[model samples]
Target: MTEMVRDNPALARFELGDGDALAVAHYRIADGAMIFTHTEVPRRLRGRGIATRLIAGALDSARARGLRIVPLCSFVVDYLERHPEADDRAD
Candidate 1:
């Protein structure tokens, strides 16, 4: 299973693979508007849908907080493009 946690106020990271193989990191903020700054799923974890999960989690968090989203991160922008339901929260 992927172990993910909000290690900090503006960051959520997930550990993938075994030992130090790779880690996926995403930076996000839920100010008046939700903004996702960065997303990176190491090459080893690339095809595993980790990015999707990260963005979904961020979007869920935004929804819970009743905040609009501004997807500055390319990954998030692309994800939202594919998932139109998420676009409703865009600001």
Candidate 2:
């Protein structure tokens, strides 16, 4: 991904891209927890690990705020399974 992506909680998602090629990792916050809902990357950006970066950034933000993560999205669940040390776990 040529464009650097950042976490944008004001939009309720992490976003990359400026045009129709945009990608997003969407989530919701509830009960002091963050629910990772889904991750979408344009086909052109799919193999570049953009989703992984987005997930990492989002998880990091959640951790900074002391928010527990509820991995509703399969991608997040998979990410957590592979990186247990991330520990953005839900109570």
Candidate 3:
């Protein structure tokens, strides 16, 4: 099971750990926007919707903070493209 998404601003990433493996979506605030920089889900954790969840967490956080989003990561952009729910949240 995925734990609640937690922000580690010092590292600029939202962490989703599943005991042994971890998934993360990174972001940085710039020019009043949250720029999503990267996303990584351990190979073993692929196809489990972990990246999707991580992206959701990141985007949700951005919205909660009332920040625009500049998705620098292709994965994040693609994910948003596929999921309109998140795409609508992008800025």
Among these predictions, the greatest TM-score belongs to: 3
- Tens-digit per-residue lDDT, 1-91, candidate 2: 4566677879899787745677788889999998888888889878877778778878888998889999888988998988999977877
Off by over 4 Å in 3: 88-91
Highest lDDT model number = 3
Whole-model lDDT per candidate: 0.65, 0.83, 0.85
- Pairs that collide in candidate 3 are none
For 1-91, candidate 3 gives per-residue lDDT tens digits of: 8388889999989999998888988888977788988899899889988888888888888888888888889998898889877663343
From the highest TM-score down, the ranking of the candidates is 3, 2, 1
Task: Give the per-residue lDDT digits (tens) of candidate 1, residues 1-91.
Answer: 4565233453354333434654444555556776667776767767777678767766776777787888777888899889988774554
Say what the RMSD of model 2 is: 2.0
Off by over 4 Å in 2: 1-4, 18-20
* Weakest lDDT window of 10 consecutive positions for candidate 2: 1-10
Q: How many Å off is the CA of 9 in candidate 3?
A: 0.5
| Top-down lDDT ranking | 3, 2, 1
Total clashing residue pairs per candidate? 0, 0, 0
Q: Candidate 3's error at 86, in angstroms?
A: 2.0
